[model samples]
Target: MAEIQPVIEVCDLCKTYYMAGGLSQSVLKHISFTIYPGEFVAIMGHSGSGKSTLMNILGCLDRPTSGTYQLSGENVSDKDDEALAIVRGQKIGFVFQNFNLLMKRTIADNVSLPLIYQGVGDEERRQRAVEMLKKVGLEGYEDRLPSQISGGMQQRVAIARALINNPSIIFADEPTGNLDSKTSDEIMELFAKLNEHGITIVLVTHEDDVADYAKRMIKIMDGEKAYDGLRADYKENQGA
Candidate 1:
């Protein structure tokens, strides 16, 4: 059998921000990990724990100050903003807590927004958007405006948009932050279904309940990796 290549690899990753006064604060310190295809991994940390910064780097929205990030076997840690944008368009999908939909736009338009950047034709974009919406269980609502839908439904639209690109991985940052517990559970079940179908998902959240849906967890504390293992093990250790 052929060896499976990791979908993501980070080694000695470090991120530091220099203030205007020449003071520097490091956000991530020498963090390293590998994520294989089809894994549902949660990156857990408090507000100041640097998980957001790490997510930005992994999603190619920002670059690291030092070290390497290999996504699907390509080094993207040092790519310029334009290059990184291209990489993100081609390989990454992002789902955010705020839903991030344009209230004025139709659901189909919002779901197909990424394709507009790629210059896909209008009809094809609509067709693809409809297919993706169906995948997320929002099939007939494509003609509705984002403002017309409930928060969870809007999030489903966001997830549909994320899927339109057929990305190598999805980065979800506090994806359930805006929803109630019941709605959060629904959304998490959706993520679990996506993962079961071989979609690689990397979710970042501070809530243990939210992170519990993930098969594995990587916990960050004060800019350092505090734990990396199965989620069940982390829970067990915490109880011990």
Candidate 2:
């Protein structure tokens, strides 16, 4: 009988960076949107389009200069770094284009790093890492070093690492930027499976093929929301 809550809500959000000459450049201009639970959304934009800045704010890695950002009902726009870090660790998972794995650590160790920061004990962390890796189809690759794996498998490890925290949302920024098309499709399929399990996913990508995997697409142009609609609507509206 009760209305479900939004996983993320952004209201009139704006971010500006001060320059060397007393100048300021805005990255997000009055951005407003809402993402509900179980949604697979893609934030699409080219370089300098402010999509990266928006991702930083959404993932609690940075704060907005104006307006409000509510993540799971908590106002995060003004949270200090420590507070934001806690929020991010507890509620969000991040996957970067570079895979961001430690080359020297085993895949299992890399996946366990977040739980370590969360104060999880060694045995539990290892167990959870194995579980997550299995989820990402890397069952036997746990003991392998990142350098020993193919680029695609390394990315799978990153995705597994992202899931080990059991976050409410996963924010993947250009997750397939380094992969070949065949491997990129595999990764996107993996993301789709995760989304089906009710974990909210919002990835940033400039490629149409990548964005098409998401149900919803929000196009950012010049630091503003150019379109927010279903992927088909976006395609039709954009004349794709």
Candidate 3:
């Protein structure tokens, strides 16, 4: 059998911010990891732990000051802004704590927004949006405005939007932060289902319960990797 290629590869990743008056703060310190296709991984840390900064770089929304990030075998760490945008549009999907939908737009329109950037025709975009919505258990919701739905349903719509582009990986940041426990579980279940179908998911959260849904966990503390291993093992070690 042929060896499976990693969907995401990071090596000695480092990020720093230079503020005014010549003060600079290092955010990520030589972070290294690899994520294979179809893996469900959670990145966890407290506020100011650099997890969010790592997420930003992994999602292609920002670049690391040094080190390498290869997405689906493409070196993206040094890519220009326009090139990064193209990489994100082609290879990544993002779900945020806030649904980030246009309240006035119909659900289908929001889900199909990425396709619009790719210049897909209206009819095709609608069809694809409907398909993605159905995948997220929101069939027949295409015409409804975001305001008409419950928070969980709005999150489902966001997941549908993330899937619209057929991305190789999805980066979810605090995806269940705003929902109640029941609704958060539902959203996590939806992510699990998506992962079962071979979609790679990288979830970022501070909540242990939410992180429990993922098979593997990578914990960051004070700009360094604190742990990187199976979630079950992490929990066991914690309990020991």
- Candidate lDDT scores, in order, read 0.96, 0.94, 0.96
Instruction: List model 2 lDDT by residue over 76-122, tens digit each.
Output: 88889899988888999999999999999999999999888789999
Write the residue-wise lDDT of candidate 1 on 152-189 in tens digits. 99999999999999999999999999999999999999
Span of ten consecutive residues with least summed lDDT in model 1: 81-90
Score candidate 3 by TM-score against the native.
Answer: 0.99
What global local distance difference test value does model 2 have?
A: 0.94
User: 126-151 in candidate 3: lDDT tens per residue?
Assistant: 99999999899999999999999999
The candidate, 1 or 2, that scores higher on lDDT is 1
Query: Candidate 3: which stretches are off by over 4 Å?
Result: none
Report clash pairs, candidate 1: none
Query: What C-alpha root-mean-square deviation, in Å, does candidate 3 show against the real structure?
Result: 0.7
Residue 137 lDDT, candidate 2, scale 0-100: 91
TM-score per candidate, in order?
A: 0.99, 0.98, 0.99
